[model samples]
Every structure is written in C-alpha cells, then in structure tokens.
Target: MSRKENAASLVQDYAEVFICPVCGDTVEVVELKSVVCPKRHTFDFAKQGYINISTRSMKVNYDKELFAARENIIMKHKLYDPLHTRLLEVIKVEAANNPRSLLLDAGAGEGSHLAKILDQMKTVTGIGIDISKEGIRLAASKSEKAMWLVGDLANIPVKDQSLHTIINILSPANYQEFKRVLIENGLMIKVVPGANYLIELRDTILEEQKRFFTNEETISLFKQHYSDVQIEELTYTKELHQEELRDLIKMSPLSWNAEQESINEVRNREHFGITIDLAILIGKNR
Candidate 1:
C-alpha cells in the first residue's frame, strides 16, 4: 500500500484517540481521506501521508534542512543509540504491570526518536506529533509504522486520558495538555540535556559563555508538574568525522546564535569528540 493508504488505515484503526482541534469533539476517519468531527471541523491527510490538525497559525523556526541533518545524526550516525536504549529500559520497567498499548511522542521532530524506540517493541503503537510540517512530512516518508501529524503542543489533537504513555525528547512540553491526554497513572518519560552535553561543540562555538550549564530549574518545574519523579543520568562521548560534525552543528540549537566563523571552525575539524549528557526524567500521572 502507498504511504497515504497506510496512514489512512492506521488512522481508521485508532480513530477513537483523536479529537477535533477546533471543537474538541470526537473525530472519525471519513472515507479513508479525511477526519471529521461532529461540529464539522475537518482535516485532510496530506499526500505525503501525514495529517495537519493544528488549530492556529504559529511561527516555527525549525526547517526541512534541520530535520534532514537530525535524521542523519540520529538514524545514520547512531549518536542517540544509548539514549534510545535507556528509554526502552525505562518504559519496560515503568509499565511493567500494564500493556503499553499507545504512545504519543510530543514534539516528535522528524520522528526518528519515536521510530527508534518503537522498533524494539512488538505491540506498542506510536503517534508522532510535531508543529513543523516539514518534520512531519519527512517523518511520514521514512516510516509507515507510526502515525505522524502536524500538531501544536498547546492543544494536542488527541482525546482526554487516552494515551498509555507519553515521551518528550529534547522538545518543549505542555504539561497540562500532556496530562489531559495521558491516562491515570500513565507513564511519562522526558529527556533534558545535562550540564556537559556537547561540551566540545560548546567550547568551540560558544567560547567563554560555554561554561557548564545546569538543568536545576527545569527539574524543579517538572517535579511540580509531575508525580513520582525520578531522574536517570547518562553521559558518554562519540567520535564523529567532519561530515558528521557538520550535521550535528546544523541539527543543534547551540550553534544557532554562534558566529559563522566559529561554526565553520568546528565543522572543518578532521575528527571531533562530542559529549552526550542527558537527564532522563520518569514520572506518572496522579
């Protein structure tokens, strides 16, 4: 089947999980082409195989090139293999008593992270939602296993208390919206950057301002929004060639504000060693 057909099939199978972005009414797949709600708010699936369910217009800085670089770094370079493994381990432990029927990857950029995690599981169905149409389109092109959609985090286009698990990785979070979609006692795994994450890149491009960072404020905020909060720290380094380093620089936000000279200097290096430090937070709904 084509990507559109496959996406339609998946949407039909899990139609009950969706809601109209405008009216908040239950949604249904219509004739395998579109989703419609009782109040007549409708969204059509794109030819690329993803649905656009966003309610309002918003500016997004991420572009197609950024997602392409990210895909190469995550899927081809395998820099995030350790992180994915840890996530899988956590998911298994946290949901030991219940079956992980459905998982929502909020702010799922290019869908690589979600795709990687779902690859190891046999029964879990994943829904990758992102505000960037470019990211969602690229994601849909790569995988038909998970449903990809262009959606806003402020108003997730999913039913209340419907998700079995929610994973947020290196993306913004809407805790209230997440709580609304997550089932009672459901699992939430959030990954935040550690103090020394990408220290090499920071030193090269960020200079003096590249001093060790902290996620204390973020951790405190998460604890306030979530219950049974637990943190797991994973730190490591990966060797990257010039091309890989270029892609990494393009994919990360740290280089966004750096001077072109600094970015060029880092990317032109023969080989670079980069640190991957992350704090994985696990929590459950009350």
Candidate 2:
C-alpha cells in the first residue's frame, strides 16, 4: 500500500481521538484520501502521507536539512540510544498498567525518537505532531507505524482525555493543552537539558553567557502541573568522528548564532568529546 493509504488506515483505526482543527468536531476518514469533519473542515493527506492539521500556515527555523542532520546524529551515530532506552523503560511501566496505549510525541521533530520507541512497543499506537511541515514530512517518509501530523501545540488536534502517554524530548511543552488531551493518570515524560549538555559545542561555538545551562525554573514549573513527579538525570560522554561532529553542530540550535569561523572550527576537529547531560522528568496528569 502507498504511504497515503497506510496513513488513512492508521487514522481510521484511531479516528476517534482526532478532532477537527477548525470546528472542534470529530473527524472521519473519507475516500481513503481525506479527513472531514461535521462542519466540512476537510484536510487531505499529503502525497508523502502526513496530514497538515494546523489551522494556520507555519514557518519554522527547523528546515529539511536540519532534520536530516538530526536524523543522522540520532540514527547513524546512536548518540541518543541510551536516552531512547530509558524512555522505553519508562513507557513500559505505564503500558503495563494499561493493556493498550495511545502515545503522542508532542513536538516530535522528524519522528525518529517516536519511531524508535514504537519499534520496541507491541501495543502502543503512536502519533507524532509538530508545527514544522518539513519535520513531519521527513517523519512520514521514515515510518508508517505512527500517524504524523503538522499541528500546533497550543491548539492540539487531538481530543480531550484521549492520550495514555506523552513523550516530550528536548522540545517545548504546552502544559495546558497537554493536560487537556491526557487521560486521568496519564504519563508525561519530559526531557530537558542539564547544565553540561553539549558542553563541547557550547564551549567552542557559544558566547560565555550562552555556554551556561540550567533547568531549575523549567523543573519547578513542571512540578506545579504534574503529580508524582520524578526526575532522572542521565549524563554521559560520546566520542564523535569528524562527520558526526559536523552533523551534531548542524542539528543543534546552539550553533545557529555562532560565527561561521567558530562553526568551522568545531566541524574541523579531528576528534570531539561531547557530553550528553539531560534531566528526564516523569509525571502523571492530575
């Protein structure tokens, strides 16, 4: 089957969870090519298989090349393998409580992380949503296991109390919308950068003030919204070759503002030692 057909089928299976982006009504799959709501707000599946479910046009800084670079760093270099493993373990604990799970990877960029997690899961239905069409397009091209959509975080396209788990990794969070879409006691696994995250790149490319990192305010805000909040700190160093180091620089926003000479300096390294320091916050919806 084509990606469009496969996406339609996936949406059909989980149509109950999706709502019309414009009218706020339940959506239905029609003619295997489009989704229509009661008020006739129709959205067609793109040729690449992902649907654009946002009400307005969006232009994001994360382009196709950026996503490609990110995919290379994550998939080829296995830079995030340990983090993915821990995410699977956390999701499994929640999956055991519920026989079947509907997981949404909010702000899922390129869907690599969600695709990897879904591969290890047997009974979880995965949905990946991002505002960047380029990221969602790249995601749809990779895996048909999850439903991919270009969506707004503040106005999520999913229905209320419908999700069993939400995984937000190194991405912004819309806590109010997230809580509205999650069922009672649903899991929220949020990963934020720790003080030493990407210290190698920061030290080389960023300003002194920008080199410092902290998530204390982020954690405190999260605690106010979630119950049974637990934080896990994962820290490690990964050795990178020249090409991997280049891709890492391309994929990170830390290098976005750096001078080309500084970027070139990091890219031209013979061997680079990078630190992956992150805090994983696991919590339940109140």
> What TM-score goes with each of the models?
0.96, 0.98
- How would you encode candidate 2's per-residue C-alpha lDDT over 9-37 as one tens digit per residue? 89988899899989889999998899999
Shift in Å, residue 61, candidate 2: 0.9
TM-score of 1: 0.96
Q: Write the per-residue lDDT of candidate 1 for residues 1-286, one digit (tens) a residue.
A: 7778789889999888888889889989887789899888889988888999876666799888899999999999999999999888877665566564888899998999989888887678889999888899988887777899898888888888988889999888999999999989889888999988998888888868555689998889899988999999999999999889989999999988788998887878999999999999999888
Model 2 bad stretches (over 4 Å)? none
Pairs in clash, predicted candidate 2: none
Q: What is the model-wide C-alpha lDDT for candidate 2?
A: 0.91
* Candidate 2: worst-modelled 10 consecutive residues by lDDT: 93-102
lDDT of each: 0.88, 0.91
Badly placed stretches (over 4 Å) of model 1 are 94-100
